[model samples]
Target: MKNFRMRVWWFLCVLPLLSACGGTEVTLGEDEDVAGMKGVVERIPAPYGAGCGIEIPVEASYLPDPGVCGNGICEDGEDMYSCMDCAVCGDGCCAGGERSWNCALDCGSVCGDHFCNGGETAATCRADCAPKLGSVLLQRVRSCRNRFPLPCNSTQTRSEFHWWDDFNVAQDKQKRTYLAQPFNPGRDGVRHLVFIIAGQQDGDMASGLTGQRDGFKDAFRDNDGSMWVGVDGQSLAYRLMAEVYRSPDDTFMGLAFDARFNYGFTPSNKQEIENAYYEWLKEKFYASNLRSIYLAGHSRGGCLAARLGRRFKQDFPQVPLILHIFDGVCHVNDHEFGTNGSGYLNPLMNMNGDWRAYSTNVGAQFPTTQNLAVYNMLSGDQVLGDFADYFVSVHAFSHASPSAVTPSFTEGDWYRQEWFTWTHNGMAHNTVSDALWHYQLSCNRFGC
Candidate 1:
């Protein structure tokens, strides 16, 4: 499919006090702007009759767009929903200034009240999503169906809930690094929590095509063709779920954690990281009124996701959960933050399974149960030849006995390993589109 992108540029608007400048001719360029915008030359009015470049806030990324759709193109539109494409809703893109908060059908769910959804009442954003209130006597009762009550299990309960956002992750980040986030928390409600973990990064390495964000938050994202890729790949899983799963009967939410939080980096740090995460995990039922969960992570995060999945599955045998390992690597970190925890990382980057069943080692130690599952996605990049010296080396899982990594459930273990051409980060940074959807379909049908 053609990767349709929307190009947004900071246009020079005529300022009120800048009438002293003359017009300057500039060339036009586009990453994915529609036709008729590629090679045009526009004259800009400058302040003081020279050249002035001052940027100002247009929209807060929330308020309604001023342009009317179906008439013409909206100014510097982001996607199909933002009313930039002028294309009507339901066409699969969120262009035309239509947002998930406004048009759930086209843009899907909004999360964290930012750009997407993650387990909150739709009515919180707009009236369309407002739960219908049925008049019962003098009071009105909200009529919502699948509100999963809390009390996750014996060890996990509602009273244990802590506002996830309040937990600052500064201890895990680099000394001066301020922009990278520790995690993005989802809302509290009866919904599915798609918890995502991002890949690893260090200062010694050069950024990839996806890691170009000012902060390391970029993820080679194919943002419904709105924002450029590598903009925010950390939250791709939840974003992809919105694109594929359109069941009005189901409500979904998501949370994304930075893999660099030193989870599983060392015995002590591993325990510390998991201690905090474990609390958050046990509180999912209380925090988001979670119904089910989908766990996905890349590189070191993948291994951690597996670890989390194992624990969650053991505790709640009746709860549904799925784990996706994107080239998982298991390593022990002993070095200081920002320095190379090189040894454990190098040997473990070759994500070989340590789990042995009858002396047969599988890809990941995680085994599937009646309700739980683990899936692995590997990059086919040759380790020594391709990414040997790259800062974030090839952490994609490769093995001689690929068939042993099957999910043992109904009808027998039928999953076969298939290698992909994406890079280590690409697995997490891609469009977060149909490929994952197809995988979910197969898993639902054939048990991971």
Candidate 2:
């Protein structure tokens, strides 16, 4: 009875303490008859019960929630504990490690991607590569123009021939134009005329005359005696005539038309351009008193010079006609030369005349006949390989079929070939003018 009373008292005392810590720990009977029974047991919270103030039951080894990833949405197959599991590859937006070459379908061919994929050329995407042939030609043209300005302003005598004051332009109904400039005009009837025809879309008469003036000045500087002829005390004797055509647009068609028709001679007339050249020539000089005539041209202009030279020889057989061709394009059809094996043979080369041809050996690819004296100028820069292939060809001489008749077989058979250390197209074209001036100076000094 005494022990039972003591146990009741202790149970009442412990019951209050056990009720106070209900969710934390539970105490069973001190000595229970049940198997595997303990004195005290930890109270595990219910499966969906609140433990640390939240409803979600967590294990001791549970990692913290990583939240959302990439665009803030917990995607399927993503690790609930990791945000990096949602990463995707080859996204077109260049996101998620997509590259232009590797994943071009998504990245589009953007520049600076370190890959020269798609239509990104060296000119368009220069950061990754070198310039292409087109870019090289463009740069060469710009550099040439910059190096040689329009007018020959380098010398005092050449500067006097201003475009507005000294030059006269004549335009026909077909819009074909030509310019005439008298270099040393005087009352004396004796005159030596020089006709300069520039390449397609090059420039107007001013540009041609400027090229001529610079060429003459360079020749005179080299050899003064033969170049300067005195018709009388009043005049230096040589005048310039240039056929100016329309400027080309910024498109390929414009370039083609300008090269084919604008600078080319008419198939029907053959004596002049489609429009004003013949009429303008007649109005400028009296044919009876003219001493001699020199015809010079560049590219397509060389074709025109050849055609006109043939006609001039037919018309004025007694007067001497000298032809100077500068990097002349050969085929009658401008486009056909690039396609066919016709080479650079032009009707001009076929014409029987005293000829002086100039070309840049850097780009000359065609085989030229040994009909005339050829000056092949080499360039240090070889970037214009395509240009050289298309324009400048390997010059081969053929003595079997001479284009022009010689006074003496020994003298005429001589190959007058010179190589200049120059590369630019402008420099190559301008070299003819320089040669002419030298020839004139030599003639004047030695009495030609």
Task: Give lDDT: candidate 1, residue 22.
Answer: 26
Find the candidate with the highest TM-score and give its number: 1
Query: Please, what are the lDDT tens digits per residue for candidate 1 over residues 204-305?
Result: 222221122444323212111111223333234323433334222343332333334542344555545555565555654553354566677666666667
For model 2, what is the C-alpha lDDT against the true structure? 0.33
Highest lDDT against the true fold, candidate: 1
Each model's backbone clash number: 28, 19
lDDT, each prediction: 0.40, 0.33
RMSD in angstroms, all models?
Answer: 18.4, 30.5
Q: Which stretches of candidate 1 lie over 4 Å from their true place?
A: 1-188, 203-235, 246-257, 262-264, 286-290, 332-368, 380-394, 398-416, 442-448
In candidate 2, which residue ranges exceed 4 Å CA deviation? Answer: 1-190, 202-209, 212-275, 332-421, 428-434, 441-448
How many angstroms is residue 202 displaced in model 2 relative to the true structure, after the best TM-score fit? 5.3
